[model samples]
Target: MANEHYAKFIEEAFVKPIRSVLIIDDDYPTLDEMLELEIIHKNGDLPPKSDKRWHDNPGRIKSVIDGFRQPQRPLLVDIHDGANVDTKGDAKVAAHLHQSDLLVLDYELDKNRPQDGARSIEILRGLITNDHFNLVVIHTSEDLDMVYREVILGLLGATSDELTEGEQEAVNQLIVEYEDVDENALQALRAAVATDQYLHARLHASTYMRTMGQGQQPYSDFCALADEAGWDNGNRRLVLRKLLADAERPLRARMRNASTAGLKWATSGVRWVKAESVFIAFSSKADHDDLFADLQNALEAWNPAPSRLFMAKLRAEMDEYGVVAQTEALERQHALAHWYARLLRSKGDERRWLIAESVLRHSDQLLNTILRRVEVFATELISSEAVAAGDNIEARCQEHFNVDLSKAAPKKKAEREHNAFVSSKSPQGWHLTTGHVFTMNSEHWICLSPACDLVPGQGATRNADFGDRTPFMAVKLHPVPVDGNHDVNSNLYIFVTLDGEVQKFCFNSQGKEAVSPVWRTLYAERRGLLDKDFGFKISAMGAGSRKLVATIHPAQVVAQLRYEYALNLLQKLGVSMTRIGLDFV
Candidate 1:
């Protein structure tokens, strides 16, 4: 009775459009009386008598049955007495059995009628075979073994090998009745019988029962059954066969609807750029080895076209963002293109050489162009200032550079009070007394004597003499970390060349006060330099080293001026210094 309640619950929850329920039992009057009472209790009407045998308190039972009856879900009920089995009356029951959507039977229909259960089984089995019934339940109080042997096994055709005379008679009766059935229905019944055999071999009884009890649609149910059965066996041929069966063939629209619904459910909230379809067809094959491989190849070959389309769209987006013409973006594109080009033109080791050479050449040219611009800018700034200031530059020159040029011309060597003046013989043996005096613009002072060793290349040896001279006066450029305060060596100085090239150097503080402090150039280039190496040995220099001085030799000043003037002209022509990597500051 509990199983019957659960079965009714399952039917109410999952099944739909149940047209009628047919009951086949030995005691027809008692079954009919109980159904009437159940309906009356469902309508909230109590029985006139309080006999417990007629009706239990209805309570939850009324609610369950009323719920099943709402909106008249099941329209009709039919009952047939099993006492009329194997007679013309049985034929009348069979004639209308296909009209019912559900079938409820008594397992032991009658003690006198030995074939009553078999007759019930035959009728239900035929309807199930033709796919006319949605559900079937044997509601008898008989033993479970009797039900399994006489009803379940007989319906499943499991005991056909050892059928009794009565069972044989029931089977013959079904054949005779099939003659009156429609051709299409008979064909479907035969196909269903074959499918039942296949299902029984693969699925357990519990799996079949549960699936049938809860299934929504016949085709979908068959698919679910096949999936459960084949899931553990690692064989899907039977599943595919069931899905592709002619009797249960899925409509094209249904397939597309199911697929679309599934996709929507699976990909909810996901964003996609495009959706399209591709079709691949193959002839049926007995061996599936080639089937999977062929499908894979087809899919792989089809992928590149769509992939290329997506990449093109991505490239278009990058172009809109100005990324393609940007520095790193251009470099990456060039590198990939150049690598592939080289690989195509050369073989093996030669390809590597070609790629490396192309990359190095591109890098060198880029660096050189950047450096040239910076050098030119710095040089022009210094030279233009020097020429425009004239003699008024002496004050600025004294402020920036330590050189002072305020004193009058010296008289005799003996009258000179400062030791800064030198009296010496030139390498050519000419005697000369050299005085350091300001140049015409007063920016820098030079040796007055033409034969002085202070002339370019003839000066006394100093640490600064080891490097080239720039006309720009050197000032203490404060050192600050470009990125953050975490730099290990923040005390740095940068000297800008007259042509705008900047050199970074740090003061070496290792020695005692016995010697003048020396500044070592850590990084030097025409453009700009960023040093990463620290805590390493470097050359030392004195404060008076010419390398520390920014003033160029007088002989080189004219050349430096001419170079800057040309750069200024280029700037007027709309050339951007910063674009070429020059930092004016």
Candidate 2:
């Protein structure tokens, strides 16, 4: 009744070891079967640790997480299932989606009531753009030939195949149990996965990191793939670094095994690897100098440059490779000590401080290095403020780390040299703001260069005054017939607000208005009768004394005014505000 055989495979292959899984399908039967299996097997009792799957073999789990290094996971959500997904259920679905590394969505629903496909995609797209992590997988069970000919090749851009014997059984069970299947469901699922960019990004990242162990070249290849895919963001880069670091975590465990076997592996000869119960291996104990050299060489070759951390790691490898050379070993020991000292003196997270302290406890000669690093941090605290606050170096120093310059001994002539060094290293004119800020409402804008006049609408009033009649009114303007290519001044937009709440607001660099091109495009594409759209509305005030509440139309000045204000705020914050445009329907 439980497909008793699957119970063993499920338990051994998934449930017992893997605590979490993403189940995806449009068929209620398939979903029921999975859920039943989970319930019957008590698999749901597994810990919901999204961060790691410890039940998996350490090596395997590492591979999986490494594969998922890209920010997002594939999420399988059955939006058509009014039971699991509905307008009201979207929030719940989204919450669940946020917890997963990937997304799986069922395109079809059993009701034949037809959920809006575009709307579903819109919701997912919105979340994907906002999150920038998570992979997506779409599942479908249409006829192989038809699917191959139509949806896969034409609509979804996926390759199709006949179901395998086991898959056939699953699909049969699904169809028999849930007789109501819609044709568009699978298409919707395929389109959702194929067209969305988040899925593409996640999949590429996961696949690349997953292949890190095959060789150094594969890891390099992955980095190239990332650059090509436009996933060159900070988090994506962090994944590459983490993958390398994690490669070190398990070396201790492996070394113990190698050491016990009397293997000549460099990892084992040194105490770099650890045993389950004890530190059986020592970094100095490893005897396989040749293996260590080769391994370190390979690792260095694989790691890209321009990273200070990577350089340090490379140096560590070189030291390991030259462990037999006493002179080189001494140099390396000193370098490592110096490195630890630098870490100790840095600012930011206290964990680095602790790590440095631990390293220092092992080597006292590192004291000088530590002191130097502290001076570097202190100098930074001073110099950065100096640049940002305009030569008030003391005030700058006080602002950054809350150091009291008033209490410190006056600077000596030599201190000027250190200041010069600090200035050289400090990023050009970039300074962290001290709490004390001086704001002045000058008649002239900050950029007083001759080209300042070229800055769009430089002196335009911040308020959107839509006549005096609508006092205390506010307005939000969006593109009219909102589905089209957006030209800020060309496309008309509707504004909504109380009609007269005026405030000075800033506009983004585009200077056209606050509306974004993408928003306008979507709005224009979906423009139709107001009553037909879920988000569109226009109404007059209620009760005996009636007045217009808000109107939807092109050329809405209120929307532009509000948008301008928001844009100004974003500019002040130094965040790019041009990503998404405004569109009104």
Best by lDDT: 1
Error of 2 at 169 (Å): 64
Question: Tens digit of lDDT per residue, candidate 2, span 1-585?
Answer: 112222232222211121222323333323444466578568646533322122343463233334333234332323223245543236655665555433434333333444323323333333433342333333333332221122111111121223457645544443233233444432332232232222122224455344443324434444444444344344333444333333333323212111221111111121111111111111111222122222223223222111222233233333333333334334567766776776667554333334545555644543333444435434543344345567565654454334446553333322433322322121111111111011112110111112221122222243123221111111212223212233424222211222232112112223344343211111110111112211221122333547534433331111212333323332432323334546978
Which digits, one per residue and each the tens of the lDDT, describe model 1 over residues 162-210? 3446645554444345445543433443444344333342234335434
Write down the lDDT of every candidate, Cα atoms only.
0.35, 0.30
In angstroms, how far off is 203's CA in candidate 1? Answer: 5.7
Using all chains and alpha carbons, the TM-scores for the candidates as numbered come to 0.22, 0.20
Which sections of candidate 1 miss by over 4 Å? 1-14, 30-74, 87-89, 113-116, 129-131, 158-585
Clash count, one per candidate: 9, 60
Once fitted onto the true fold, the runs of candidate 2 whose alpha carbons sit more than 4 angstroms away are: 1-24, 28-82, 114-119, 122-132, 139-439, 443-585
Candidate 2 has its poorest 10 consecutive residues by lDDT at: 429-438
